[model samples]
Target chain A: MEGFIIALFVCMVLALISKYLSIPAIPFYILAGVILGKAGLGVVHSDEISRFFSEMGLLFLLFFMGLELKLERIIANPSKVLKGGFIGLTIDMGIGFIAAYLLGFSLMESFIVGAAFYITSTAIVITSLIENRKLMFKETETIIWVTIFEDIVLIVILALLSASDQNLLFFFAKIALALVFMYGISYYGKEFLVSILDRDDELPILFTFAAVLTTASFALFLGIPETLMVIALGAALATTDPDAFEQHARPFKDVFLVLFFVFFGITIDFSGGINWFIIAVICSLAIVSKLISGMIIGLTIHGSALSGLEIWSNTISRGEFSIALAVLYGSPVIATTIAALVIVTSIVGSFTAKYSTWLRRGIVSRSRKKALMHRPH
Target chain B: MTLRSLNLPGVGTKYEFETDKGDTVAIFFTKTGIIQMYTLQKGCKTPSAAEMSPVEARRLGNILTGAIIEADQESVEIAFSALADLRITIHTFFVTPAVVGKTIEELQIRAKTGTTVIAVCRHDRNIINPPPTFAFEKGDAALVIGESDQIKTFEREIMVN
Candidate 1:
């Protein structure tokens, strides 16, 4: 308890600093965990409270993601999302998986690495775009869509992974049944749901909180993954009043998610023989793969290589989801490697994202100079 | 006149357009009902951005919808010439307590003030050309037509105390 309190206090201070610097707090939280946990001073251990807070953090994060997953938009433009998403899945995940496989990790470990590698930190990417004021740029749309695509893929990956150990058919059947049940409730109770949400009293907040917890608890009761259940709950609520749920649920997600990241960092065990070469290679591939995939997305979707460069620059940071994947499913070695990958890529990605414009300009000017020089005299 | 909207995933939807002034304006309506507006001037790299709460955004929307300088109340008054020298006017009045629950025939409005009650707007329902036996209710807006002075007399005597 004392350790958890001290850890949160440190995270709070770190969060303030990260906010002040206009950087994503995710990497910092993980790094703070690395410093405070078994790998560092060994002051903080994962207690029940911390673990529960961490679980809430991950659940609420997915719940928020599910709430924001406006299916209409994706349905409205299926081709763009598919093309960009497919290319990204193939390139980033393919590379991460292939490289990890070749590096002597088990196939499952490679799959986990590849999954983490494939997902760019949506939080980091979106925040940087708005902070950098790149929202108005033409490439910004493609960048945003690619993140959405990644989110969708993340959900699918999570589902597949959760169902891997169980009877696949039964798992999917249960999921479908749960989904239908949820949708039915949402459809039938739409008016009641909206009325409750519209209320300014504590009922709305309580309903939102209870709805999530109920879904999670019910999922456990039904032998369904609470992760999927909460997401389903969020999606069902989204049809009625997503904004209300988001507003009411945000306070819990915000505080808990901070602990989630911090505790994830704290729980990382690095004593399992560090592999620097493999870690360096995977980290490098994380950047290179995004660059390749982002460029493809740019050239094909946006018709500008420079736009691809811009997308690549913004997306290189793999923070929250990557760490989540690592913490949730990864072995100790995989966790340590991913933690390193996240710390390195996020810090490097921040600088690259910030100066991406300058990088693009330099490349453009250099190419123009070459064209000028190559012209017949 | 043309607007492009993009889904911002975890954020909300963003509607953007280049204004006639050649400045690009983007408005983001977040999933949580907060609104963020950004304007980028031509040839500028950065945009000026402002965030508004839902209430603030709605207030601004109301202003933009011209709620502040609403349609003039007199615009509701209709005037026409029945004869070259005589002008008839139509107007609306809020039914106060003095006129509430009073039937048109009982009030004898047409006989006393020479004004015909054209309609009674109660809540969302409008009673057009209300009958003589129609009773006025509190909160009803009575639409009447007559000579200007007669309408004035009707308002002074019937619509209010």
Candidate 2:
């Protein structure tokens, strides 16, 4: 069908744009989605295909997250990552929860919004940090550690999202059972498989993907949450041969992620149902709350206000997870608004982070000037 | 052997490490230790890459070499903060008669300056974690990890008449 070809063309154009611009490619992908999907020309119309791929994208995203997750490192103590993540999560979710309620969303939708805003895009921040040679600095390190914690927190939210719609006990119990089984298989299976194959690279990936797919299919047949099953599979696989998956499966994740974003874009009706003002307000509030969240986390880590600001600046963008949440719980109004917010924050977040030093200095000088003007002789 | 090196002439060398899945990971490294990475997969001919620059090429190189593993944010902070006691610094001495002839043991850098010479990079040599018996040569640049005050102490010994 033309669906696959149309998807490829959109992704290609987005890729070209990303090549010239020094930003995360997600927002651009979204833009491509906007142009090609229902919001625009309506070129690709197969909802079933797009939906399936989007679901796959979500699995792949979490899978990649699992691969990069240095579980042992994080578990190794009551360290900065834990501390900052704890503080950031508190502020982000707490503020987001209040804000969502004030805006009149249901309890479920409020949780979704809070969870969505609670995360800063690790992909965007890490990219900029390395590009600008900011990693050597203490603040950048704080961001990295904080991101690890954020990932774990988001995983919890993802679990909640999957369990949100269901009769809690049923969904959660099955998910738990599935997770236990998956973990045992992944943890034990890794060593057994490695004996049969050494550093071959291809096998671990193929095996893991195959296993996850099988689990997903089985879950679907059994009426369990397939998304949660895949996520559990990914996290468990992380305990096994992470290097191989990171090397091989990551590329597939990226490809599918592009598909997911395009699908997300297509589903959004950028027309007229959503209130633009509410979107604008929430978007603005998201910016402030994220800054506050990052700052608290950063401050807790390094005990510096500037460090907190740097953290905020570093991770202001919302990407895959946020969009996934929006698609799930967000109404047409909310989804469209979120798309706009993601686009704005992604660009703004990068700029703020890149020129944080200058921005800080400018603020300091202006405040000094204000103090001088107010002083009595 | 799909891991071919491309000379980006103006930028520096780019190493494209193609995984067995036919996914290409290109790490573009510059002389000054800047590293940018890109990945291509899915038979998408257009190389729509993310400029993955979250760590130094030097640090990443060390990671690849197993010199560092999982030195995450907290651990790195602790290590750097500990540098108040002693830090890492590199200095190159352009072949002086006084400093060139002494062996590392004779130079006694650790004893005198509390500075351990982690590596000695000659123009044509890679002497990482050099032995104490490693003799000092003209134009030897040493990467030392020590306290600031101690680095000053060691610099004097290396810059002789």
Candidate 3:
């Protein structure tokens, strides 16, 4: 209890600092975990209560992801989403995977590293776009689509990683059956579900809580992974009343997700000698890979490299989902590497997102000056 | 003017159109009911944007449509007194897809809500006491007189599907 209280207090302080600076609180929370946990001062340990809260945090985060997934919207604009999504996947994930493989990590660790590298921080990206008032720009739309695409791909990655050792066919069939059954219930009970969601009392929240808990517990009972089931449940519920579900579940997600990040930070072991060279290389590549993909997407979709620069500037951060991947599936070295990546990229992303317009303007004027100098007067 | 709408995925729908001044105006209607309007002029490097609450947007809409004209409180009260005595008021509803292409007879507005269509205001002209067979067109504003509850009924039944 004392340790938990201390951890939360330190996190609260860090959260305040991050908020005051108008930057992301994610990397700060993880840093607090590192400082307080065994890696630094050794003040906090992973107790049962903290562990449970952390798990809730991860589950709610995934559930929130499911709620936000609007498949129809993605389908309606498949061209842009696919074009931007594939460009990002090939370049970002490809570079991340290859880089990690050459750095002496195992195959699975490399895949984890690659995925963490590939998935940019959606919260950081979206929040900064709104803050920077860049939403009106053409490239903003492409950036959003790519994030949505990464989210969909992350779900697949999580499922594959979780069920890697299971009998592949049976695992897939079971998940498929569960998803179909959930979808059928949501479809047939759409009216009933909406009616319940529209209620102004406690039932709506209770129902949401009960639905998530029941799904989690049931998945555990059936020996299926709870993460995928909760996400499936969320997606099914989304077909009914996603906004309402989000409203009711947001409080739980907010509190629990903080614990999830901090606990993840706490568990990251740096006892093995730190690989500074590899970490530096991976961090640099994380930024460069986004630049390459952002340029490609911008040129193909928006017809301008400056717009690509804007996209890369806003998307340089690897945040919550990356850390979630590390905590869920990474080895100690992988976790440490990802923590460093998130901390560095997110801080850098905040500044770049803020000043990207100035950067673009600088480049434009510089090019124009060169053009003028080369011309005969 | 034709409005081009683009889906902004997680944000909202963006409706853009070029004005007579050759400036492109994009209005974003977010799912959370916030409205953002951006105007980009030719040769301008950055667009000018403004954010508004849904209520503010509606008030601006009323002004744009000339529904709420600039009148002092006393003058507005005097104008309302003419209809206040009989508990009757006027409501102006723009023609929506649900009511467009339907004749006054088909809508049975009088029978359904005990309201009378006093006038139909189109872009160029206003028609007083339109005939029963008069078919409504898009962008036409029907000015009807009725009690408050009857006006609500008309809005519920006819103005929207």
Candidate 4:
């Protein structure tokens, strides 16, 4: 507990540094964690308390994604959601598997690795997008919807992976039950919940936290993914009054999501236990694979490479989710390797978004120039 | 170098500032003092966005493209440093038959005080630099420009008690 508090204090100091320098703090917080954890100074351990905060962070991240994408919209566009979500996962996982297989890992290990690589870090990508003011871009909607779909698939896999004893069939059965449960509560129970809570500011926030706790606890009891369950809770409330829920729930979500990134950093083993060179080569390919996948997805929807670039630019970073997968599924070597990949990819992905505007303009102008040169004077 | 007005029908009046750096920004100014900014993506329009504060709005307004805001020269932004400098302030005195029959030259307002009445808002119309022959009506609002003290004194002398 003391170690966690000191770690929080360390994050605060790094945050101040980031502010003074006028840079985003997502990367800095992770770097700070690495420096403070056993990876560097051995100052802060990923204690049980920190682990709890980390899990809360994922729950809140997905929950807000639920808030933004809203339940009605998600249900309305099932085909669009599934297609957009499938593109990035299919590409990254394919790359992850092939890379792992070529590196002589077994089929199961390869599948685990591919699944882990399939997820883009919601925390880092969403945080960077908002901070850089790229949240208003035309492609932002396309990017977010795709990510929401990815997270939905991710949680299902997480549920399956976490409960090793349960077969996929049982998980699917539970999911069907959960969906029915979600539909009933969101459609029928919304008004009652809102009336019970009223418009009290603090209680709405408390209720949001309670909602997370109750659903997360139930998910554990049911052998389902807690991440998916909290998202369900948020979706239920979103179906009621999205604005009120957003106003109440955002602050709690923000604080914990920061802890999620830091906890991700603390878990990395920068010591010789991890193989850096092999992971670096493999991760670079994964990043390229993500971009190619995004481009394909964008093309399929918008019928233009430029639109594809939009999806690619926003969806390239694979952070906390990949790290979560690594910890759960990877052998010790692979898990540590993935941790390194998360840090590198997040930095690369965010910087891509940071300068995406410049890139877009340059490409547009160059294309125009080429067209002009070909035209008769 | 040039400002393009992208005043969409449903959207707010948007002004694009094309910079020498080749990057452009679209600022959507609403009726209320709210500013919505976009990165001006080439092929995309109407991106769902966030709002910036009035201070930022003003800064963006000033720096982006030269918007000649007539009243913003000695604006509150520079009002403290430009304290002694000439300032433009509109003092709308509610006239109840007070100097209702008066004309500008007859009033000798400029000769008596350093304040200049730049325009008059009568009902829905604005008559800028109203001719000396122009008569002041019951509800005429005078837009004056002068030093701070001069403006106050001019208001006091002309406004009905």
TM-score of chain B of each: 0.51, 0.45, 0.49, 0.49
Q: Interface RMSD (Å), each candidate?
A: 2.5, 14.1, 1.5, 9.7
lDDT of each: 0.85, 0.70, 0.87, 0.70
Model 2 ranges with Cα > 4 A deviation: A164-171, A195-205, A361-377, B1-161
lDDT of 2: 0.70
lDDT of 2 by residue, A279-340 (tens): 77777887898778777766666777777777778888888778877876787766887787
lDDT of 4 by residue, B58-156 (tens): 656555443234442321222334666544444444444766888888878888777777888899799998888888887766777766577667767
DockQ of each: 0.26, 0.03, 0.32, 0.10
For each candidate in turn, give its C-alpha RMSD to the true structure in angstroms.
9.0, 14.6, 10.9, 10.9
Q: Write out fnat for all predictions, comma-separated.
A: 0.41, 0.00, 0.35, 0.18
| lDDT (Cα, tens digit) per residue for candidate 1, span A138-189 | 7777777788888889888889888889998999999999999998999999
Please estimate how well model 1 matches the true structure, expressed as its whole-model Cα lDDT.
0.85
- Model 4, A257-362: lDDT tens per residue? 7787787777767554656667887778877887798789878887878878877777777776676677557776676667667767777787787777778789
- The number of the candidate with the highest DockQ is 3
Candidate ordering by DockQ (highest first):
3, 1, 4, 2
lDDT of 3 by residue, A280-305 (tens): 99999999999999999888888889
Quick one: best lDDT, which candidate?
Answer: 3
If the candidates were sorted by their lDDT against the true structure, best first, what order would they fall in? Answer: 3, 1, 2, 4
